[model samples]
Target: MSNRGAGGLLGRRPPEEETGLPKDEIFDLMSNHRRRYTIHHCKQADGPVSLSDLAEQVAAWEKDKSISELGSAERKTVYTSLQQTHLPRLERAGIVTYENGEVELTNQTERLDIYLDIVPENSIPWGVYYLGLSFLSCLVVVGLWMDVLPTGAVPTLVYPTIIIAAFTVSAAYHALANRRYRFENLDEPL
Candidate 1:
């Protein structure tokens, strides 16, 4: 049998539809710094967050100051931008619901997290660290094979075994840490 159409014996259905907004739209929604900040705050919020509070927090971040120290000018500027520009854009993208001076994340919010990986400043990227580890491991293996270093002092497999084990453990720890991010456990202590 060569038939593989919809009515054919295989009867394969269409591909499963994506659950939320399209990826392009999600990226567009996250393209702005203010909108991204709003989503981050909403994710940590216990419930619907007042727009005023959200604006204050965003302003503090922009000014590198504490919320208590945020001037009225800074707060008002951020508040106006959010209300007149960013919030409406986010609302249109279905990523958040804004109403009555309060904003809440919708189901589309979960999609944002996958795109918003916030690495702290002055931190080494994990890929570079892993690559360095791998290079060192390979160098050690080559040295052991060529007897360039002490050949009889230690077992040949020990170096590779330790490197592999370290990589595995590090991967597991990173996964656990990502899964236990602040937004996922607002009620739990870090």
Candidate 2:
């Protein structure tokens, strides 16, 4: 017999190819709170979970009340959020399959490993980076206006230019610091 090795038939290919789920789709699937929780619960569950059961669990966790006790208003809100926002996205991602009244984790053993690795606990905030850049830019502009440095020694614009260069260096450092941890969905491999 040819040695297929440890993965058997399932682990033969890299995890990405085996799942047929794209990296972006997987990231989107796990980004949200409810969907993430649902996947986590399903992973631990013994078998397929019905929609009602899943809803009941979510409702209890979110509202601290039974699904039945939720009034029409609350029910409408939850139903809309689930049907419109959560289920469609999860279904499309191939992480969860919806059938009849139940949703089941499809090919759980094959996909779980990929899902865990792709979805990280934290992400670099692009907003923070841009904001810092803006703040530094502003500081440099003010320094130039104030004539804080010796004139003719360096052009007025040169001060800001040096600051800009420093900012670029720091930004590059930040990007590199978090580069390994970046989600594959957000950035292409360098």
Candidate 3:
């Protein structure tokens, strides 16, 4: 592992192989809501964005409104927060560079994305979902063993095979969805 930061009781910082982040720092930077929104907007933009534009977008996201529909207060609230707090935090973390009233993503910005995820309120985590699928697979296998489930037309292992295949496909789909927030692919279609 790369020792990019001084090691202590906390252990060596995580290597920068892909995420360009120490594992601990990623969480710290992502802890605030505004910073998360700042990085999200930076990734979504096609190029460097003015501070005012970024704040407007973030305010729009928070209000679930279009830019033109946003009240001055809404935009100003986000703008002040970003200018005085969030942008500086992100810059210090090397996730973005804000200068002269404009902000742009750095290579580290892409890595920051790994720390942010938006999940629906009603949804179980993917790991739990996969575990549930595995449990169902095992139950099917046991049902076959006990002959409680009819395996008359197909092989005894067929039901379990289908269940495992379903899990594999679902996991792959979710993996791709996780990458949907990546900076490099932001301009690409989902």
- RMSD to the true structure for each prediction, in A, is 6.8, 12.6, 5.6
Off by over 4 Å in 1: 1-27, 64-74, 147-151, 172-190
lDDT (0 to 1) per candidate = 0.76, 0.64, 0.76
Q: Can you write out model 3's per-residue Cα lDDT over 1-190, one digit (the tens) per residue?
A: 5545464324644445556667777878777767767777777778899999989988887887889999999999999999998888888878789899999989876555545555545877888988888888888888887999987887777786798789889988898877764543553212
Off by over 4 Å in 3: 1-24, 71-77, 151-153, 176-190
Q: What is the per-residue lDDT of model 2 for residues 56-85, given as tens digits with 9 covering 90 to 100?
A: 656555676766786666655655677677
Candidate 2 global lDDT:
0.64
Q: lDDT score of model 3?
A: 0.76
TM-scores of all models?
Answer: 0.67, 0.46, 0.71
Residue 56, candidate 3: how far off, in angstroms? 2.2
Residue range with the least summed lDDT across 10 consecutive positions in model 3: 181-190
